[model samples]
Target: MRRLAILMLLPLAACSSSAGEGTASTPAPPPTSPQAPAQPRDLTTNLAVPWAVAFLPSGDALVTERDSARVLRVTPQGQATPIGKVPGVAAAGEGGLMGIAVSPTFAQDRFIYLHFTASDDNRVVRFRYDNGIGPLQPIVTGIPKGDNHNGGRIAFGPDKYLYIATGETYKTHLAQDKKSLGGKILRVTPTGEPAPGNPFGSRVWTYGHRNVQGLAWDDQGRMYATEFGQNTYDEINRIEKGKNYGWPEVEGVGGKPEYTDPLLTWSTDEASPSGLAYAKGSLWAAALRGERLWQIPLTADGEAARPVPHFQDRYGRLRAAVQAPDGTLWITTSNKDGRGDPAQGDDRILTLPLP
Candidate 1:
């Protein structure tokens, strides 16, 4: 151990709880400061349209291959093994196998939930994971699907209910229709039933969303979602149950009576927001057209500050940004998703320390 030679005098510290009389002990030398920004590293390469990643309790990641409709169990050593195929996935433009969520009680139930585009609609299903993944059961279905704007991100909230983000599929009226699952945030149980405390007594938690692709929660258990604007504004919203988010009526902020304004908004060119993750007291939003990660520092109550962009244009078309169980930020490139130019190993999972 190195010797500590301090010039300033200090008061005597209390002895350890187990110490005898007059036996003094140095207090845990003031807890050290936190550290970050340890250079990004590619965990796995040669992925095809990787959309979202969810970690198993064992720390192996369950990654969704959007176009192929397959799930790969990616190990920490950059090795991937095909766990199994999510059945009935029909791939189309921006619609296919999209988001994944491992059960909060996965150690016992071993249930994995998946969001995918079917032949007619986008849907959610739960499947058991034994040695292989199989025996799919419908969780929620009949979300209107189209070539684009099929929002598919699922996450289990701190309340232990699954939250699903759905796009309007370019249908203008569906956003305002509470009866339709399209363009709405749906909350349900693991078995596909409406969560008990849902605002409308149905799976539709909040209506009037154009395209919501990202869902995250802060330390205070408040929810936040990233939404795609029509042609002008991209937005980050503080989601509350049963509250209306102005979509077809208002793009960004109208401050209307029936609608909740977004917490933060950006130009469409700057942030075509997709996957979002809350880590290190900030919301990290991924962009597709912007091809960058927006790090927006958030207050305890989930207020947003000026966002700082990192890894802009260096990596082409980021689609998914998530924080792994071990506190690492994992991002996926969307260059191969028929939108941007594909580089060598075009799509991949890049892991970095949360800054």
Candidate 2:
């Protein structure tokens, strides 16, 4: 692998302020100056289809395997141990045990949450992890599921509410249905009820997404998400409360007045984006089909600058990118996910230091 160097560019006056949603605009030119080189090191190898990563308060990480439904505890020293397999996972196609999140108040609650494809639907559940996984308690349930597009990513925002990303389950009409949990980002309390200040007075935060797998928040608490586009373009969207992303109605930058546009978009061949993380004034997106990491720099005002791509084809298929508690970036590969040609030690987690 080659050394990765990021350019810290100054914000341009032409850059749109992170205000209302609009179509993808021209980005500012790349910076003339370059930062120090950052290199990625494989933290663990020979893992099954690892999907999501969450960091414990102790600096350890909890990783979920999509097909196996197993959770592994990974130490900072690169040691990986299987803690337990979540029961009742219906591993198929793009569904299974997908996302895992350590509670923001984990030190006090000892609760870890998971999103998985059950027999009937995709659901979120929590278990108290003292030394081992406790009995399961379902929080959010009845999310639509399908052989594909089983959007399953969960995280706790800075507000302490749990946010969920759900797919339309190949049912495009569901994207427009606020009453349906499919194709929407749901915000709920710890107990799975609708959050107090939710837009629709229910769990739906935003709707009209085809398949959103990545969610991240900037320092200012602004939310962003990565969505898989249907054969045309992939998107990085600046999420707002109750806004529709125009999924089946449109893809990429529609420039339609009624629907919000994406902040950035790439051709499907260049980016099947997933697992987004915010760090060092940039949004890092892991690409599955593109087999690279994209660093999208942000201005002081939170507008997006030119995006830089790194590690193209060096790693087979990148699935997840997350910022660790210690400030390093951790990413997982997805070569073993049936769509890619597996390399030696096909599925693995790699770590890189940020500038």
Candidate 3:
């Protein structure tokens, strides 16, 4: 068994104990840090390569299955029900139904957005969920798609504008191309129009990203994103409007004046980070290749402090990390995603208490 180590530079709070896997608490070594909470409990299991998770106003979560193109409603108590399969999803290598976001005004508009791969390209669509998914309304389209690097993650920023993250689709030059939607973070209105005050007249908010898969906002509404590097590094960037994050030109950090450097970087083996959520004064990131959950503490100035790893290799291929309405963190495993080894209840959602 791999030995677990607890290291702390700041005093972190603890969550109420709960029944779950690895429930036997590992005693802390010294008087420096508090004991880590019990291992996360399985919320739901047997999912087919679950990709993204979004919470409805009712507190139930809607989860997406990448290859199956199905949407499932998971109750707070861990019951999952397949609402419907998304139409027009072309599941291929690393591309399929990926990101889901509930409208900020979901209670009134009943709108939900999805980012998925189509037969020709990757796109974002809007649907009304009355009881089932409504007709497909394509809002954003023409994102480049390839066997890998189909950047797929979407969320509504505190500004109420929809933010879309896209990859270069392995076409390196596209990362610097302003006209192309691929390899960029786009800011658009709920109706799919270019958001007012966008640096570029088009939907492009920022450019020069390799593959961005995670987006989150801190308490002060500062934006952050996670990007995958070619082979050397993975990055957590403090997002700013119109800033260029050097991609092919600079893999990790280039002191070049024209491009913005990442706030923090990790070796690719340590963090191929995916879904990200902000809670309890920290950013929680889910790692795919590293198979861990990273909690990065933030300073008062919105800078990253130190990142602490949890559940390293405990769950296989952690994909999505989302904070539920009740403050608990919900994470999904991706063991059934073809690249991972599936366990008995492969592709499961697990819940942990936030510190």
Candidate 4:
């Protein structure tokens, strides 16, 4: 969900326990030094309030803009054209054109997956784009939605399954309620049915999340997610099957011993993390409230390094980030979507040099 406008106004909550424990807890480990960029480069500019971006086989970027509900085909040369429009989007507080993913087998299927909040419920749809025909078909439906805490991030995992992040929809306790779809990571087939052997035997992979917005996988095939916190800190967690990360019951780590703990936590003031991508032995998160790009170096052990902010405040609020086939980072802007001071060109897709 978008946090740029509402962030500064929300009353701050006291710092909670880091990861599941409260006070006087043992420090996990000293974070390593921040990794330096190989050589930073300013890629391109001029776009709408883009919320998400994905790369095509040809190296072109497919970007989604929130308020406008438009998708664009972006070239390395900075050229952009409207690809098509998604249907049934409800643009409000945090709802709009949210996430886009190219089919894992795009070379053959030419399918594209989208996550958006509809007038009723938030839904996932897989569609085809065959040139003349516009927005194709809806493959998944019936996800619960709320004005706040609408977790709307989707991606294809290394296992060739579609994964979805859900929020508790302002109903905090729903996070722990296994019967409901909110506040859980859902793993499903390309056709949107629960995949075989899911932890809950339902669609849920893991439960007890407040509002998860970022999903990525490391080289070792471990899944990681970024979640929005109410007041104190935002979290980065290693997602495991059947393990519950304390939500309404716990904020960061240090709530109850039974629940899984977060791998890393950052001041919400410093990070309203959204899209997450792992590449080159590191993880990158787009910071909406922090107005920066964060690069975290992961140990071979798969734990998080201290977050290092890049282009701090230079490019407005960043919403979604992804690594392209060419090894460059693709990032989108969120300024034009009723948040922050919109740059003359508040929304645009950018390419960053990765080490």
**Runs in model 4 lying further than 4 Å from the true structure:** 1-35, 38-44, 132-135
lDDT of 2 by residue, 243-282 (tens): 9999889887777877888878776666788899999888
| lDDT agreement with native, every candidate | 0.82, 0.85, 0.85, 0.76
Candidate 2: what lDDT? Answer: 0.85
Which one wins by lDDT: 1 or 2?
2
Give the per-residue lDDT of model 3 (tens digit) for 1-355: 1112223223322210110000112323322332353579999999998999999999999999999999999999999999899999999878999999999999899999999999999999999998788998999989899878898999999999999999988798999999999899999999899999999899999999988989999999999998877656678888999999998798666878899888777666676888999988788899888789988777677866556789999888988989999999999999888778899998899999865
> How many backbone clashes does every candidate have?
0, 0, 0, 12
Clash count, candidate 4: 12
Q: Which ranges in model 1 have alpha carbons more than 4 Å from their true place? A: 1-36
Candidate 1 clashes: the total is 0
Best by TM-score: 2
Enumerate residue pairs that collide in model 2.
none
What does candidate 4 score in Cα RMSD to the true structure? 5.5
Model 1, position 220: C-alpha lDDT score: 90
